[model samples]
Target: MATLMLQGTGSDVGKSVLVAGLCRALSNRGLRVMPFKPQNMSNNAAVTSDGGEIGRAQALQAIAARVELHSDMNPVLLKPQADRQSQLIVHGKVRGILGSSNFREARRNLLPQVMESYYRLSKQCDIVMVEGAGSPAEINLREGDIANMGFARVANVPVVLVGDIDRGGVIAAIAGTKMVIDSADSAMIHGFIINKFRGDPALFEDGYQSIEQISGWRGYGIVPWLSDAVRLPSEDAVILEKPVSSAKKRQIIACPILPRIANFDDLDPLKLEPEVELVMVPPGTPIPAEAALIILPGSKATIADMSAIRDQGWDIDMLSHHRRGGAIWGICGGYQMLGRTISDPHGIEGPIRDIAGLGLLDIATELAPLKELKAVRGTAFDEVLEGYEMHVGITSGADCKRPFALLQRQRPEGAISADGLVIGTYCHGFLGSTALRRAMLQRLRINSDGRDYVASVDAALDNIASELERYVDIDGLLRIAAGAGQ
Candidate 1:
């Protein structure tokens, strides 16, 4: 088995998409490929087939590789719930909370577990596509780092540095990485790939050569801006920092961008609706009164996000919108916040034990040790809704009588209000269903484009794979991977 790692010159340099494209390219060549990330820090998570969660990006890569999602793909996940504290997940289960104080030491100790995952993946695949989080340039974090060169050196995996040309510092980002990182660490990096080039590739020929000359790294390829990437599920909330869609449409759907929002991509499918505008309301912005539907999104820390909602006075906006006859929906943690109260007696989410909910539904939630993680299928909106349930908490009350969907085994999932104006469900990816998306849009009295969203994403993977095959040196990368353990 062989392995090659892709590390970025800086954060968001297109490592995740590049890895996914490369995974599909290699898999198309009849190579058994598996994607691996030693450590990832993102609130956006995907429930794996093994009843654990991994970074959403790895899940996309696995899909590109035509393999089942595995928690071992990302062994250590840090979900930031606060400025300094993070929720720690190991091998598909929540271990505990990690604060700034013990973050380094805790990660340092997990090197063994990370390697365990890497070796297990190696046993099952001909080549493993390893992804590095952030940049290896941050020498300050290199002490106990498993996200970048630290893992590269320990595993003896060759690294290919990726720099973002669209960011306007491609030369410095690539060459300077070599200047800043230790000599021993720099030895792991064998080549560089320039990503997100907007203009003619010929315009930057000299610059690309300069990077190779200065960094003493071989040039892999220069990738053009991928417009289809918008169709893929984003792996980080940094994409949300951009302003809301300015497109004018017939109906409006509003959602708040919570501080610790997880799986927010559940709404990405809705963005494809031409007649509907999906507005993501940021902090200090009121939920638009013109929106026909208001969606309370999922959060990593329910109570804290609820507190933040109230702090932002969105609670008042929701009530006023409700009186005006606007529909409301909640998913996962948002479902918990729609209830009467949420109690965390065990302090699972810090000192805030119990907090008042929006009281839109009669249900109440109690946080428990065991997390609910599974794929589910059922009929909702008169369409077959196939999605996953990944959350922590037990919710039940009179609203349960009006279950949103009749899941398998006659199990009731979610709750619907008596007036049919409010609905809440624990299932994520509900909107990914084309029919469900059409149903939701029909409620807004708009028409869906009737696109098979799931298949579209699948096609997108193949498309990206074709691009990588054309531009990137897949054979060269394979040769490097073949050199592993030599």
Candidate 2:
């Protein structure tokens, strides 16, 4: 099998974006390439065509490669549940909740499954470019690490080390990572790429040579920062904090940044509206006094993050906003937080066990046995909405009296308060659709020329792919993957 691995010096070093670009670039050369990540730790997940949950980044990569997306691309996924604890998902199904100490043991048992998925994809694609999860220098995690060097070493794939120059310490990061990796894993790296470089590329010529000498690796390329990346939907919640100018009407939408943020993509549709400004106020950021709406984003750690929201003075801020006639919307975990109480008897989120919510709505939530996962079509605020559900909470109480959306041939999915100002839903990505966005904007007396969000992103990807085709040695990359070039 012809395979290559893209490992990073550290997290958020542009590995995910680079993989997407390379996938598009290689596919443009008339070769079929598939993106794979042996294991991933992300709350931002996408539903597969066959009805499975995989990392959102891998889904983007699949689209870039022009291939059908599948859960096999990411065999293992960990959704954070509490401090150093997470829900383990294997091949799209939940295994169980495990602490950080137990994940390694679980990973050892899941190796065969990982191999099964890898070889299956290997046989179906011309080339498989695998992306590693985090830094290889995390020596403390080296023994039980299945996502980085561990998987790369077993898969026998050559590696390309990608470093972010924008983060500074490009040379030190690359050199330090090399110094810490196992000898065998270090040897797998054939070359390195300097990513997210700003200013002139020639300015880094000397630095590149110095790095090459220190690490004894060849310089593959220096990739400049792509400014149009904002048009793309980001899977990482940490990267979604860029602020935009508020609409002329000054109608504001606020999102409480929960500890285990997940599936925040529900706001994408609202973001495109000219009359809407989506503001994410993390813990400690004071809520604006004149804000009209507050949104509570999805979180993996519902109970714990609810505590975090309470600690950040948001609890007080939200109450003040509500008293001022401001509207509040919640999704998934946030939906649960709107209720009077949340009972986590199983310790699914943390050691503290059960907790109370903001009580904005008259609902009460209990962590449930079965996770709801389905594509739902529904109605909310007189607008037809379509989204996917992925939550494990059963809600009840007076606020549950009004349904948020009409779904699946007459079933309603979500809660709408009597005043119609408070809304909560378990569905994520409900706003990415243009129809939904336009309707939301109209509610605020805002006018907008709706844009096709998905298409705009696809066009951006096409542009990046075209640019990469002109710059990279496409044929040489193919040959290298085929095990012909050194």
Give the per-residue lDDT digits (tens) of candidate 2, residues 1-486.
678788888898878887888888878777788899999988988777666788888988998899987889998988876777878888887778878777778787787888788988998988898999888889988886788878877777778889999989999999998888878878878788888888888999999999999999887888888765666667777686656656453467778777788987777666666666678786668877667678898888788888888788888998888877778889999999988899976655555367889888889988876777667777776777877888887898887768888887878778877877788888887776677777766765666678887787777777777755655555555555777123
lDDT of each prediction vs. the true structure? 0.90, 0.80
lDDT of 1 at 134: 93
lDDT of 1 at 284: 93
Task: Looking at model 1, report the run of 10 residues with the lowest lDDT sum.
Answer: 241-250
Clashes of 2: 1
The superposed Cα distance between candidate 2 and the true structure at residue 309, in angstroms, equals: 2.3
> Candidate 1 has which clashing residue pairs, if any?
none
